[model samples]
Target chain A: MAETRTRGRAPTDPPASFVWTRRIVLTLLAVFTLVPVYAMVSSSLKPLEDVQGKFRWIPSEPTIRPYIDMWSTVPLARYFVNSVIVAGGATLASVVIAIGAAYAVSRYRFAGRRVFTVTVLSTQMFPGILFLLPLFLIFVNVGNATGLALYGSRGALILTYLTFSLPFSIWMLAGYFESIPRELDEAARVDGCGPVGALLRVIVPASLPGIVAVTVYAFMTAWGEVLFASVMTNDQTRTLAIGLQGYSTQHEVYWNQVMAASLVVSIPVVAGFLLLQRFLVAGLTAGSVK
Target chain B: MTSAKVSAAGAARAEGAAAAHGAGPGGSTGGRRRRRLPGKALPYLLLAPAVAAELIVHVVPIAVGIWMSFKELTLFYIREWSKAPGKGLGNYRVAVDVDGAIGADLLRSFLVTLAVTVLAVGLSWLLGTTAAVLMQERFRGRGPLRAIFLVPYALPVYTAVMTWAFMFQRDNGMVNHVLADQLHVTGGDRPFWLIGNNSFWALVTVIVWRSWPFAFLVLMAGLQNISRDLYEASALDGAGVWRQIRHITLPALRPINQVLVLVLFLWTFNDFNTPFVLFGKAAPAGGDLISVHIYHASFVTWNFGTGSAMSVLLLLFLLLVTAAYLLVTSRRRPAHG
Candidate 1:
């Protein structure tokens, strides 16, 4: 990887045309990437009439009215709270569960260990949509049979999100655990630490980056999920993704508020990504890249 | 590395020998002591929660979904879907039979899905490879440029799709404003991007924009693994940039690209958010991908059985594709362990 850095110019200057062409292409791609984001932010600041009327690159009369109205106009704040609860809960649960399984898979040899690894990988093969209908049916049936209403609940959404997030989390964290030398765990065990204790004190601290990566992955999965959220959530428990749909209905579209709320919903995840991008990239390309 | 491998192999043999000796009556005291403890069950204990959750949430539901497809489960029998009368391929016939109501739509949706996945994945792979290769060259502002390129992938799906939806508005969209008013590309006839035939292109544009960044990221990482000496060696042989990329870069990146394309194909085929958020309950005729089509059939029309059948067919198709993909890639790397 370090060699790739020196592969380009051989410590010599390239021609002026090559440099200019590179800069121009980079600038063009940057503009292409940033335009929609610019439009989103600028349009969010604009008044309703301006959003529906002319095409302005910058808002002539910029105001935070949309942001102010977003909370009062709909259940935007409620949805944000719901998203926080669901994503936070799911992230915590997924990381904890994946940590244990990943440790076992990475450290100890056991029966069906190969099968366990294969199962984790196979879960990624199935599309989430394939499970929707059956899961919905099961939830409804279980509710009716046992008087436990799982449908339209945050718990249900969290569980469904686990289906989407846990496989990748386990895969990534297991890889991270593998990279940590087994000597550390043995050393910890020799010093009066048991299997669980060594994992907590030594392995967990050493694998903080991987743990952070898994947490972000799980959080982002729960946060941005829409297909299941839309089906499984109701008015009181709607997530941010489902709640954003409130802006567009059969009657009227609230473009300004939608844009404002989109930004609000996106800030935490995007900030998380920017901060932990290295770990996130590592997690995403865990097995496939090598 | 060789020493590490040798030691690992020795450790495995030692463990196997210990287990084999423990089975006999005259085992070593250390082996007996190790077996006396319940530590052997620790791995299974730790794995229980994940396995349980996956089985309950994913596996069982999938089994139930497959069963549901054979029954006449609709809104009327949804509550008692367990007891719904078995239709014995009746639902499958309805889904695949061209003369039936939903059969034609199902076929059309499959075609649209195929086209969308092929185009979106192909274009994204092309754009991503080009951008990644370009970024490989040492240049000014490359760090920030790379980060900027990742914005589309980093943004939440709903936010990105909503922004595109806003941009794709028919009358007052920025797309029309730019093309019709500013650039005069369309000659005062603003195309309706959100509806009718053009929605396919609009949806494709949004998907391509969102997905290319992932391909770029993967390819960039893959590029890092390629020995730069190869490029220098090729360059020394008077090979042009294109030839070097074709021979050295593409072959080196083939493994990553294989996985990338398959994942992209599956994702784009099953993508529900873009079309759903952009078009609402029913996508335009031109843009009705199978995911949304199944979604509407089950949810909007309250035909669970038919939806399950369609989804089951989709699952089988994806399974075949994934198996074939793994087969091809796994064959290439027989040393994978």
Candidate 2:
């Protein structure tokens, strides 16, 4: 990796003052990052009343009751399942579709290549709310016309998330694929492999880091999404974002349970992201040039 | 991956190869054009889903949204939005009229969003650049520190914002407990964070914490490209650490920084999740980002026409800003590939 070239310290040994400054800055930044997280985690462990009246650095009576009660309190298990299905489905579909489109852009040039590229790039800048109402109307209309249940279905959420994820994924993956040398794919083609075969065998294996990075990103975006979930989802399809927000709005907000549920929901993605963090760094390094 | 990093060199080779092999048909990746009858249709077939997805999700919806904006499409006409009577500029007029209630409120949210976007993006970039540079040096425990630094980014957005909302509670929140009780920064009385003026900073806080790590990651990737030789040369020429950073590091990172800063700006401006999760449907006046504000205008207020008009204006403003930004940046680096 090009990064290995610059990993070590430069020829000069830094002065003590520079070392101290770096330590202080890094420490301060890390504290800034971790304190709120600590607040959330510590608060989640406290009993209900303990989190309601005052902020305690340490819970006076530490308990896991919030974790125990959070599921029963709001059907949190159901919402978690819904989030997993919707976000996971969306990520899978986006990656699969984006692989084809990104390969098309990076490895071939069609007549509308620049148009498709520019359109996807600019489309990213539009806010989600711009399309929410019309898309809702379209969903409703389609459901009415075809009886497909497009408005309040989990599939609807997946489709909407694809809207959010697909374009950017194509744009990004194309850049990553562009960074990969073209000779490898050519060599595969010469060995009696077609485009799909070359893409699957050579490009796919070589760009695992980029694919994983995009997959995690798309999943996280859908997982925590609030806007579309609020409107597109119904009682049966409530995702964690809407479910937790609804829980917090209930009378006598259960701060502890809400925090507990949030923690439980966050851990999977956080752990997955941390485990794959190195790939993301390498992937972005390859794509960042363009 | 390293073997594949020949985009710059391979282009020269690709041209030579293309000429030698005789360009039968063009647009091949690295080799000369391969025009087998079956291969000719493959790229379009591959791109079909992407184009269709764009049309159905983005292009069609945008066109329909524009049509709705020009009509009196409110809750009354939501079911049959296509039949909503056209009002031409009536919806836009109400949205832009400064003295009118809706327009004034919309203007306030826009300004608030502008301020928050500026502060958050600037601070995130600064903190991220600082951390990336600091982390560039080889040190013990750097890996763990980098992971810890990215925790906010990795954590669910709702989780982080909800934590802030809890922490910013008037009586029970930790912001007051630490700043007032421990540090005595608040004037005797505990100030509210989710409402009134302080909500802006509270909004900015969550935005910066979650997004700075992204900037940090990108800049760190960018920093790896800068050769140590540049730093060594500067050091031998009597340049101090700060001088080397200012002259060598900053200039080396210009291209990536341009892309990073723009991305951060766009993300922060378009961010509805933070404000929505933090303040809920009816965002406070001070922290009402335009995205949430438009959501409120359309959904909460049940005035889709006005909301759609605001959306059009926002889109236009973003496009204009992006065009101007690109033009200025390109002029500065006209030779950039």
Q: Model 1, which residues run further than 4 Å from truth?
A: A1-21, A284-290, B1-38, B232-243, B326-337
lDDT tens digits, residue span B80-183, model 2: 76678999999999999999999899999999999999999999999999999878776777889999988988887788889989989989999899988999
List the lowest-lDDT window of 10 residues for candidate 2 chain A: A1-10
The Cα error of candidate 1 at residue B199, in Å, is 0.8
Docking level of model 1: acceptable
Q: Which candidate is the best by lDDT?
A: 2
Per-residue lDDT tens digits for candidate 1, residues A28-96, read 778878999998899999988878786678887999999998887778889999999998988898899
lDDT of 2 by residue, A1-290 (tens): 01233344565666666778888898899889999989889989998878878789999999999999888878788898999999999889889999999898778755776666666656666777788878988998888778899999999889778757676567557767877887788788889998899999999998887898778877877887888889999988999988998668788899989888889999988998899878767756655543
Rate residue A34 of model 1 by lDDT: 90
Off by over 4 Å in 2: A1-8, A179-183, B1-38
What TM-score would chain B receive for each of the candidates shown?
Answer: 0.85, 0.88
Question: Judged by TM-score, which candidate is best?
Answer: 2
Candidate 1 residue pairs in clash (backbone atoms < 3 Å):
none
